[model samples]
Target: MGTKFRSSCPISSALDILGDKWTLLIIRDIMFGKKSTFKDFSSSGEKIASGILANRLAKLETLGILHKGKLPDNRKTVIYSLTQKGIELLPIIVDMILWSDNNLGDHVDEKMRELAKKIRLDKEAFVNNYTGHLKSLMAAL
Candidate 1:
């Protein structure tokens, strides 16, 4: 995690926080995707290394992007949830997913393509629905 931006430019400053490969993936997992716990995250198909995962998690927390909490069912279990700042990344993720699905076509997963098709067919509805769902989930937390 960078302590300072390369320049005062908006893009430069934003990238200073999010430019690393692992950061966005961790954000995506915590904010909208499934994986939450250290174990769950390590188990993802992407297989992010333990050291890298730990570092990224701490960085995100330090940035106030997410917070760690005990699982409701088991106080012993640690889980992570996105702060409002982390949830704000959802639209960016949606855009990236749609772009890759369209531009890369067959290289993308069939299920993801189907999802992308649905999103493209009704982007506003999808965004609105997904955004609402995320907000509700955050509220429930």
Candidate 2:
């Protein structure tokens, strides 16, 4: 998985992998929405196209941010879970949620707005608790 970097800048380099519109959304779905299978993601409210979802899932796996697996009893079912590196993105995602809740106003969903309030109450605790939950989820996978 050789990715071409646009520049040596850290933000630019990170964007090379995550700057796309759909990549982080897919990550967001896996992290927050608890979406794992292709069908679950395809049925998301954003309605991402199948080709783009497949491409982004592959890219995330290549970048070491996601781990793809199969169900124990159902060989045909594909599942995706976040790696430790991907789990580290929780802070960034939480910050984005808070930022959107503050700036996006009504555009943000009610559930996210509620989450923003919880995040604001104690950001560190929220992140820590959620990170633990995600780690446990990964362990169960």
Candidate 3:
């Protein structure tokens, strides 16, 4: 699935799908390194509860940003992954991280700040090279 077209304006359309704080943060988590399970997301310090996490996961799937599935041998575990539409938001996520690091002042790590700067400088190239891993991550969902 993909973003549902609401109006011709891109901003309006994007907000219709990802306007909420949790949705974007969930996408950020998955794209950055929270791919495996719900526990990983909560552990990131956002402290999202199980119920809200489940709802956000469902909502993201409905918005086409996420796809969910269970591991074959571990039915008890569910994996959440970003779709192509979701991966396309990488630059936006990177920009947010960079902005937070710059403005939040000491909340984020210095090494991570450096990495985010590198990422922001070459967003397109970084995304292009990560396509294969992105696909594999999606497949895990």
Candidate 4:
């Protein structure tokens, strides 16, 4: 969640909904690979606190960015998957990755460099194809 705001410029409004550092990183992790449980997300390098992670997940779910479901075999564990609205943000993430790669290449892996190059070449196609793959996986679940 975020601090309350007084009025709404649409851009400001949207940012307010997603302005927190932890929130964006959480979305990034989900977009990249972490999407099954609190454990998966907590282990991501940003080192989000457990209580904060739970709150942010709840917030994203409320904002329609994520949907929660139970595993078929184990009702105690929950799976978090991106909604179409959430998947729609992939191009934005891709662009951020490209920008980071340009500015911070030395620390990033060769595989990531290659993947970022591919993502930069055709961001829309990459996102569209990835979105389709996620949807297919969701259907299979």
Candidate 5:
């Protein structure tokens, strides 16, 4: 949504929005971790640059993948939460975990491997639980 599509191909368009490493990392944080603010993202272990984080957050919002707004209790504090479309990417993340553990086993940690196993054990249940968590968090917003 932030830029013109390079081609009419669906893959290209998706890449336009999510091809970069940082975007999905940002999504990973929001979807799986407690990354809800600019500070949280900037301070993550990935150490995403401040400018890059801001731009990615805005781009995700423009693409309707996230909702950025002020916290209800504190007008000045901000929050970034996933949209319905964003939460739909859970399976993709889970799949990537499986793939990473399979092909890049050395790089994946035991925790991630365990998660991938859990996902493999029951993909539907994992997806349901993750999506339910997202919905409940969004409801609180």
Candidate 6:
């Protein structure tokens, strides 16, 4: 799980872990898509490869961004949940979504555009409410 940082800068170091194309998508799936299992992630719209998904999941777990666990009824089934550190990424994710909505208007779907508008109305409240919900969900797990 040890990663070698390319530079000492915080942004560079953070990017060293998260810069991969699929990592944040995985996080997005867990956070907003209500996806937890390996099967769920593999079947995402992005269609991430199984091997790559496994690698990214492991990396996230190692980085303390995700917690790996087993489903209560099915011990063999693996579930991935966001850690507190991962929950902290909400603002960044929201900003990314807003940026896409604003700068890539036509490309964004109507549903997301609407959500972005709601988010724009009060970005802090949106992030805070979602963060609280996620933390409660994690606690329930």
Better of 1 and 2 by TM-score: 2
lDDT (tens digit, per residue) of candidate 4 on 45-71: 778899999999998898888888888
Those runs of model 4 whose alpha carbons end farther than 4 Å from true positions after fitting are 1-6, 109-111
Q: Quick one: best lDDT, which candidate?
A: 2
Where is model 5 more than 4 Å wrong at Cα?
A: none
lDDT, candidate 3, 46-96, per-residue tens: 677788888888888887777787877999988888888888887777677
lDDT of 6 by residue, 4-68 (tens): 99989999988999898999999988888899999999999889999999999998999999999
- If both were scored by lDDT, which would come out higher, candidate 2 or candidate 3? 2
| 1-141 per-residue lDDT for model 5 (tens digits) | 448999989999889888998999999989877789998888888899898899999989998999999988898988999999999988888888889989997788787888888898998899999899999998888
- Selected candidate, larger TM-score, 1 vs 5: 5
RMSD (Å) per prediction: 1.9, 0.9, 2.9, 2.5, 1.3, 1.1
Model 6 lDDT at residue 112: 76
Candidate 3: list runs displaced more than 4 Å.
1-8
Q: Return whichever of 1 and 3 wins on lDDT.
A: 1
lDDT of each: 0.82, 0.93, 0.77, 0.80, 0.89, 0.92
**Sort order, lDDT high to low:** 2, 6, 5, 1, 4, 3
Score candidate 5 by TM-score against the native.
Answer: 0.93
Instruction: Give a tens-digit lDDT track for model 2, residues 45-64.
Output: 99999999999999899989
TM-score of each: 0.90, 0.97, 0.79, 0.85, 0.93, 0.95
Return the clash pairs for model 4, or none: none
**Clash number for every model?**
0, 0, 0, 0, 0, 0
Predicted structure 1: lDDT: 0.82
Answer with 1 or 4, whichever has the higher lDDT.
Answer: 1
